[model samples]
Target chain A: GESVGLHLPTLSVQEGDNSIINCAYSNSASDYFIWYKQESGKGPQFIIDIRSNMDKRQGQRVTVLLNKTVKHLSLQIAATQPGDSAVYFCAENEGSSNTGKLIFGQGTTLQVKP
Target chain B: GAGVSQSPSNKVTEKGKDVELRCDPISGHTALYWYRQSLGQGLEFLIYFQGNSAPDKSGLPSDRFSAERTGGSVSTLTIQRTQQEDSAVYLCASSSMAGGSYEQYFGPGTRLTVT
Candidate 1:
């Protein structure tokens, strides 16, 4: 019954603009979260990750915000570029499980318009 | 410096045939994982292996699916009597449990098509 899901199936953004993708997770025991980007015909690439202890984590051009209260997670991309267009996924790991298995969300298609 | 690698970039097999997918994890990584990605869907966890511990077979979809990791390095996922619904991209990933980073580095994936 535990699952991760995205708020939007597709999100379009203008070049140079900022993009925000939202996700909602049903598991309260999830302590670790990760955001991944997948280009067409390629494997999912690690973008950023956040632990339950931290509310936010930042990477080069991306940031992941985790709201434990609402069981919500979001990925923010600054200065969205054509290269940023890809399907993004949010995944979570149950803290109590030592196996480190991850449950992934459906995915959000981020489309950048020039 | 090399990352995870999977073999036979793609495979097409007839229904009811058996297929084996291979994965090579990064050097020094003690954790290995297998996932399935259906078209337009997120990655589905299949199984995991850590050190010499028994694999966590909880994620395996059915008895027809089985995997083995040799010497804590190379891994092979075998699907017996595949069905059309088994068509998907199989991804392999590895992470270092030493640091507790849990960040899994993924391979390019083997696209399996059950015809």
Candidate 2:
């Protein structure tokens, strides 16, 4: 469990096991959410995204679940590996129009243990 | 098919000095953004640019912080009278479109250290 607008929390899981990282966003008007993965010393790389219309979306080995009621979002990685270890971030699109401005939540550092 | 690129991957500047960071967005991408991440902190939205439209400067922290995108291609984020608190990794991202639904490609980022 994580709080809104706080420092990043960490999740450690053994290799081959699934890992779940949670985020609580602050805005109720946000209609889109995105998950990103960032390796040490690198920028965030987009992992998966889901619109408000959908509660869940799946990608290769990754799944994003959104709960609008609680403003909570989670990223589940299947069969986590060492290469999958990174800081996971959930961002909300607060822009009402077509602009891409985003408000990011505190990230979760996912550590995979071999 | 190049991704977003940032220059001066590392910067060390004295307090009160000014620093400029550059970002080259993906080819033909119409949206560019700047974000700052302090150590152990999440990304902070700074500014955003969409094509030739006026940029959204609402996220800027203060009057000393400013940015500009020239010719709708490259963007520069300038921090005037830099302070020690300005030390952080500055990240740049670009989206193929100007909308929130599109994915944003990020650069490696510039690490700025103000002493």
Best by lDDT: 1
Query: Which tens-of-lDDT digit does each residue in B29-71 have in candidate 2?
Result: 9989999999988898899998888999988999999999999
| lDDT (Cα) of model 2 | 0.88
Tell me which residue pairs clash in candidate 2: none
DockQ for each candidate? 0.80, 0.74
Candidate 1, residue A55: CA error in Å? 0.8
Q: Estimate each model's TM-score.
A: 0.97, 0.94
Docking class of 1: medium
What are the Cα lDDT values of the candidates?
0.93, 0.88
